[model samples]
Target: MIRRPVLLRAARPVALTLLVLFGTGTGTIDLWAQPVQKPLTKQAQTELDTIGAELRANARKREQKHQSARQIAEEMERLRTQMIDIARTQGASEKRAAIYRSRLETLTLLEADMTRRLGTLRNKQSRLLSALQIYSRNPPPTIFVSTRKANDAVIAAIILKEITPELKKRAAVLSEQNRDLIRVRREAALQNEALFISESDVSEQQKQLETLMADRAALEDQLLREADAIEARNLELEARQRTLLGLPSPLRAPQGRALDLQLPVVGEKAGSYGESIDGQTNRGLRLKTAPGAQVRSPGNGRVEYAGPLEGYGQVVILDVGGDYRIVMTGLGRVYVDPNRTVAKGEPLGRTPNLTDKPTIFYMELRKGENPVNPASGFDLTKL
Candidate 1:
């Protein structure tokens, strides 16, 4: 009887644990293993079982919905990656188009330059032909023709008097040896024609050579322009890359840095700085003066661009320190060699005639890449 009580006490705790485990996922197995007993009302047990079955179904549905949502999210992520790749491809195409457009512009300029040079060559050839014709027609005026019959007869008589009677009688036999001067002159005219043909052929050949040279020169200029554009593009791309990589911008010289052109005799302001009288915007400040007037360098540095440039006539570009450049234009002739270093107020060359309208000295100053108007930069005290 005591053993029975002890066993019942242990069985009570085991029963509670089985009830807790059944309430979780082991409910079906527990129900099958346990003996059927009418401890609670049959209606209440049936209702509890039905609610557990409904709960299990709802959990399974929720799991399915969660899995579907995860798959959709993964697909959306993949599409977003593809879109980014497409955008990058579009950007690359745009850059290529821009480069091609620049190249086309450069090619157009080259063609125009070549056309101008060819026209110049043709004009030179025409002038040469005219000069050759004038030379051939006015042959030195030194060859004199005598038309005095007395002189001719006297010359013939002298010859007869000097000769013996037998020789004089043989004169008729020698008469057949006399040559025709008209025939000689005709041959000379033919020679002149041959020379003209030769000279014309040479001139044409020279013109052809000049055309070839101009073509090559234009090609070179185009190449240089293209190279510069490419370099600029590369620089821009690099700058963008640096920005993307979170780098600081490169330092450059400040704009409108004051420069000194150590000239001693600063000429007067022959003309006020403004647009041309025609209202066209002037590229630089023009100081009107006579030809052969001394031009002073505006700044001290090595000369960069020193030659005959279009529109500006003769120009000398000086490279001042700190990325400053000074352009002195409208020169009559360049007296200094390129790459020569000069001080401010240094004599450059004589001022050239500005198409006979005015003898002007055009000056401009640049700091770094920005242009500072000469009117604003230079001291106009000496003008």
Candidate 2:
């Protein structure tokens, strides 16, 4: 007997608990407020700004990497189809061989570049880890002695000690940077491997056509299927790697209900549920955010739909679990694809920066086909 896949079940008690915990007298939850940070010195503030910039850059890079990989896979599929057509008609011409060789060379160059980048990222990671380990073992030396006996050397030492915390903070930031770099590198390497395999298959097909005089239609169909299978395998492998790196995996069993979900983007509330817009009642919460603000996933889920809709500019529909889905719309660009699993806090896209108009994001939570108030299940009052 074949065992059927288990469907996710809802934890109604947890959902009710969330409703009680986040409900305000006004019947809405605010998720944008964050704890105030202590004032920092000018230098410390500058360092923090630098770190923030680096993190944003890393996020951009990771998104770009995924986009590039997707493009390459699509190109490979297109080329495979073209090869099939050519095999059916021209029967392995010199031009076909040349095209195959050219593509292989391009893939080789891309693999080399990714290898170099990975090496550099790993080196930086090693250095940062070593520094963090040393700092952990040897705490900053104390310089304060008796105030009466303090001299110029003592004062200098005290000043150095004061800088120790900042140094440690920098090290910690570097460590996080390394982790991001490493993730991107791993993704790049996977793409390179996929490309390499595609090139190898093309080369093998070419050789068979030249020497073995294989049946054109039969060989083409077999290779095309193999290419499709390889692409699917690559996607599965990449998904697994992402899961190992702490991101969500669609294949993994749901652990528990995600009752307390955060807002996908940080912004001021613009519209509320039950509000009328264009003769229709609004079924979700809306926010006005700065142009080009990054939008993130509010909960761990597989992307069921990620593309432009008739009314919404760009939309991402995530199936959280137990028939619960989250819909986010009004994006300028989408970073993820349909069927990809996304973790909570993972970047999904960016809001458009329109100079003349405010960038508005619309979000909704649903159980099956029925729309529900997002606040009913999520505590969005605090980050």
Candidate 3:
């Protein structure tokens, strides 16, 4: 367990409830993306500069030190809290997209489940009808049989009388299940309609959001300091990685004991840092993100390398501070140039569009030359 970290110490318990009630038909909510470009107030600009300076300083630190887990968690939590404050409401576009994508996914899964249940009900009904068919095909022997068999006929009649109520009960159950089949069909159709609408909305919104993000990035660029030297080093690392087909060593820095990214993309929980999945041990935290989802930097850092490599798609490596680096993979686009200093919540790129599965964002943290549990940097033991 980790000691109380900064963000967790200040955070309160939150309870979330998810309700999936289906309607007979689809519904629509008119939505629009009109990001107004506002000039940063003087105070905002000052805050940005402060954050940038901290990132730059962290990137240059060369001190080497060892600390207990508590010390590391505390330090990482402090930086995480700062970068989160930098995020603000600047992610309006991506935030909307995530909401829609989540809705579409929920509907898709719900339809699949309903379809499975409907099939099971149909099969059960067929088996039950077959079992009752013999009774249905013949009536009990008439009571007007020969004298020797008259008693047997009477007994059979009595038995049928006793079982009549049970048969009716079974009939009622079958009727309800038929209604259920109908309802499931209606819900499935509703979901399909909703899914189509949501997909279209997402595609349109992605285009507009990309444009909005570019404008914001352009404005912020003019206010930030230039990093020519850092860029040069990144280019060299990029070259080496291509030649050797391996990750480059961390450029000297993170004087701080703990490290973490707030999480670049908002996505569904995939796995923890050390969990074993399939047959391999997971080395990083992975999040399942939707196609065209925007990925932002989780904390203050410098882009050590950005772009595609052989096995990995478009990737970004950030040198946060003191022998520390953050590597992200499975991105479709990389917007930031390598070696550029970025504050928390800056858009890094977009995930590729895929048909079979949602994009899985893979993130890992390294200290010097070894991979470590990324969760160790967070102070989440409290709440």
Worst 10 residues of 3 by lDDT: 12-21
Alpha-carbon lDDT, every model: 0.50, 0.59, 0.55
Pairs clashing in candidate 3?
A: 253-321, 253-322, 253-323, 254-321, 254-322
Error of 1 at 358 (Å): 5.3
How does candidate 2 fare on TM-score?
0.35
Among residues 3 or more apart in sequence or in different chains, the pairs in candidate 2 whose N, CA or C atoms overlap within 3 Å are 30-380, 30-381, 31-380
Which run of 10 residues does model 1 get worst, by summed lDDT?
1-10
Alpha carbon deviation, residue 288, candidate 2 (Å)? 0.7
Per-residue lDDT of model 3, residues 242-301, tens digit only: 223222343334334376456677566587778898978888877786554567887898
lDDT (Cα) of model 2: 0.59
TM-score preference between candidates 1 and 3, better one: 3
Mind giving the per-residue lDDT tens digits that candidate 2 earns over 54-81? 4344444533443443344344445556
Clashes of each: 8, 3, 5
